[model samples]
Target chain A: MTTSREIRLKSRPVGLPQASNFELATVDLPAPGPDEVQVRNLWMSVDPYMRGRMYDRPSYVPPFQLGQALQGGAVGEVVASNDPDFKPGDIVSSMFGWREYYNASPKALAAGGLGAITKLDTHGIPPQAFLGVVGMPGLTAYVGLLRIAALKDGDVVFVSAAAGAVGSVVCQIAKLKGHTVIGSAGGPEKVAFLKSIGVDHVIDYKATPDVVAELAKVAPKGIDVYFENVGGVHLEAAINSARPFARFALCGMISQYNETGKPEGPPNIIQAVGKSLRLEGFIVSNHVDMFPQFAKDMAEWIKAGKITWKETVEEGVERAPDAFVKLFTGENLGKMLVKLA
Target chain B: MTTSREIRLKSRPVGLPQASNFELATVDLPAPGPDEVQVRNLWMSVDPYMRGRMYDRPSYVPPFQLGQALQGGAVGEVVASNDPDFKPGDIVSSMFGWREYYNASPKALAAGGLGAITKLDTHGIPPQAFLGVVGMPGLTAYVGLLRIAALKDGDVVFVSAAAGAVGSVVCQIAKLKGHTVIGSAGGPEKVAFLKSIGVDHVIDYKATPDVVAELAKVAPKGIDVYFENVGGVHLEAAINSARPFARFALCGMISQYNETGKPEGPPNIIQAVGKSLRLEGFIVSNHVDMFPQFAKDMAEWIKAGKITWKETVEEGVERAPDAFVKLFTGENLGKMLVKLA
Candidate 1:
């Protein structure tokens, strides 16, 4: 018998969740049943969607139960296994919770849990990269930009949360595609990080009094595809800057995730009619076909040194709660990682 | 030479326009210049879009001149022609104003003016029908419902302003394609008209307090395609009823046309993102290929007596202003028409 360190839901948060919303505890672990793999988690992914899991309301996925161990995407090594597909010593990733160890079911990723996807290939890149540039959010940016936005070369792209895991990848993809990429972030550091990734224009809406005026100067031709990672004021700004036939790809509403039940109604969709615009919302899991392509291309990009990434590591499973809370405040940069023994 | 009776703009209204906003006067017809055609107007279409012309702001089409004659689709016999494609006594339709006669420049309609497209056959259908049921609004319904919405047969369709010019035709087309069609109208009379055209379900939202609840009873599966001819409360209701992958074809915002500038925003577009919906706004003019197909199918529907239509005809060019305002009040049973000499 072994004990798995876990962080459970302690309280429902009002705004950007704090450490008080979670509780770090230990639970007795049962040995792996047949067709199950026992994993010793090394790193966990901190994402915006976790905010929804704490609420009781019906969302894309089920809400986490109070005092129950919360689960999401985590990279771990198989300490023991009874499954034919998974063997001991193999590094596997689970869309499971903030636990130091977990017993992952043999089923496909879809049935595993929230944010669960197909088995990821950690061939050329570091295992923690699966939590950052090679994981769900990265694939999300790729599919949302290339397929959903139907982005064309020279098309202008405007991404919200420009230095975020998904937004950072969106900026790089936009740059690689030869498009004029502009982004908005909270502070000077995040804005500077966006510029570091080859973003053509970065606006620290905090420093810039008029976001519209700044975007207008950088993107005189206007935005073609707006990759919306953050909602609220950023969305309002994108709406004002959108060009004719502009497309707003609704990927994440990170800014509005803390709202009681759904975000407040937007002021004008009627503008869509006049501009002949197309606004579509998409879930990353819906684009299943793109996974193989994402893997191949991402692997190639990493091998060719075409891409570089970062991880904000929080040591020990007890620190997972703090790492998760800091995600909302721009406290941690790049992909926030929770490392465990 | 007879003076043409024309309706010119007098003042822009604050909300719903009134008769005082128009100035009807008789003016001498100018002789046709080179590449010009003089047409004795037969039928001029007075549509909901004319309300936008009353404002000075830019729209998909140019704003209606404050002191100049407001124009729309009109079919008439050419009295004289200096252009090669048009001849005297030939039936032609172009962007002619509310007048008994108009001298149109080829530059007004570039390429070939009224002569560029096929003349109205008006065989099985009435010539006035060419201004409506088989005309601009019909094609608007077609493209918005079919091409942009990418409708699949048997999909549930919900239409707002269900008995108006555009909604009336859209319901019938959806029904013919084996779809379950639902509609919401202002009053019992209009709701009855919606059912007469083969809509499966009807909700008089003005009579029903909760639109979402009312739609929920009938559309347990939720709405797949929302043909939005009206926006506002109806738009909010549609968002709540929208199924995953719902498509909202925004052919018009007749609900907001009376406003001088940008209309107030609908409160439910954020739901559009949550539900993974696509909202597309377009004008029928952009989907021109549907014309020949529309002419063929509409003629067949007329010949087989597959269609029954109602017209609120305001006699003469003088009554165009009242007729236009009556539309905003839902006074018309089907299409609001203005007949000219």
Candidate 2:
């Protein structure tokens, strides 16, 4: 027996989510039971932090339950093996996404250390780029710009979803470390895909009428490293274009992920105490100890082409709730995936 | 020649500063102008971070200028010295505060190293407790709780103007480091002076209408060191009662420092990214290297009585703008001086 179809959750989103709040269903596996491991899925992921596991509260993971089967980040393969660390065609990666097939018990798919299961090598890359650029949004833009905004040397960074997928790997790692990068995003094709990567300054927060005066007319001697993926008014334009001691790095906000209520924060958050600012907030599974030096500096910055990525996909598994309602309608630009073979 | 009088800034406030925006003037002091010293004033400080140097813009200290003379934290005595490291009477301490004395030049009052005019060994305490609790609101509550909320060890904390003067020494140093604090302020005499110091939950934010459901009903196992001094809605009840890796610190906000406009922040500031929190923002002269371990642990926590302080004065130099507008009507509770003798 084999079956599998999955999807579930059929009701939880109270804000911007509705593909009838999902529900595909079908299941039936069988033969594997001892130390299990069946697998199948191919590519899954569709973030915006799964809208905070559809809100039943108490966060930092655990919440998505309802009719079940929703988890995320996928990339599979194994197809039967009594699990001697996976076998039949290997290729792992889990969190056990909105299914297509699953069996588990490889220690329950490697219990939550970056949602474990782990087995892919993909040195040639593209195993759905391990559910996005070197995975988990390139270790969340390398642990929020080198260990939560500690990225020094002339920091001027600023990011705010600069063309998605962990703000396009934090605008190509703050333009490959030479710093000075700014990038907000919304239209004009994610502002020409953040000026085709070298970013240097690209607002277009939907043709700005004031993203804090277009980030003070292009960071006039300010910003010292924000990152924060799109919170309200881009976190009040990075606390009104900070400078003295600025740091930020909050990571994900996706504009209040469909706020039903409490969502109007950042009115110059008291210019973070006259600009001593720090901010922080993080969670890429609490920095999976920077995954083997973020898989060796993202495989040498994607083989020296200095990293680049973008994927919208949405092919099967019932278009995975239309690729998570096109990540709250910015209509996906950098990594939204679904494929699910 | 000497005649002092001072005060100044007769025009700059637009929001809550009315006392016709201050002014008194008189001037006419000129004695030791060479390696100067002179002093005289007796106890000044009137802070809610001196309403952020009466806002004119560029912050972290410089602003209050208008017609001049308004720097803060005083406590004088020297009365003439031409400097060989002060002598006349010594007892110093100075930001050259708002009036009655002046001579300067100890390298321009120690060039902004904690508003320099040093010389004060008030070890037996009270020379205005070096301008409130061993100075600079007790080193801004010991560098915002042991170095910007790095407090740890079963942390709980909370704070928010817990009866002022650097939140009553950050609620007795998080209840003498045993933790579980809470505090908030306003009314019922600063909630019975934070239940006479041993605070382990006090709140009263103007008899709560719902300070995030009264900080989730007195931190039901939440807060892990907030201390943010009263920003709107107490920074939305410390980001809705943070917990997971919480931290905060952010020294002052005095409820948005008499907001003339841009305020409204902290509507659950995106629960600081699912509670990984951190916040930060500080400025005790950028941690004057924790001022000799905060004046030797605040003189052994005020000589083992485990710390306690409250002032409110307002005697002369013409009620120093009514002690800086009774610190915006919460009507001063702990350290709000003025005596200027």
Best by lDDT: 2
Poorest stretch of ten by lDDT in candidate 2 chain A: A106-115
Task: Please give, for residues B116-214, the per-residue lDDT of candidate 1 as tens digits.
Answer: 433555664677777778888787888888898989966899999888888888888888788999998888888878877889999998789888788
On residues A229-263, what C-alpha lDDT tens digit does candidate 1 reach at each position?
87766776676677778888988777676665545
The most accurate candidate by DockQ is: 1
Model 1 docking category: medium
- Model 2 interface CAPRI class: acceptable
Candidate 2 lDDT, A24-108, residue by residue in tens = 9888878779888888989889898888888888787788888988888899899898868679988898888888888878787
Which whole-number lDDT from 0 to 100 does residue A163 have in model 2? Answer: 86
DockQ, all models: 0.55, 0.30
**Each model's lDDT:** 0.79, 0.84
- lDDT string, candidate 2, B52-121, tens digits: 7777877767788798878888888987887787788778888878787888877775767877888888
For each of the candidates, give the backbone clash count: 7, 0
- Chain B TM-scores, listed for every candidate in order, come to 0.91, 0.38
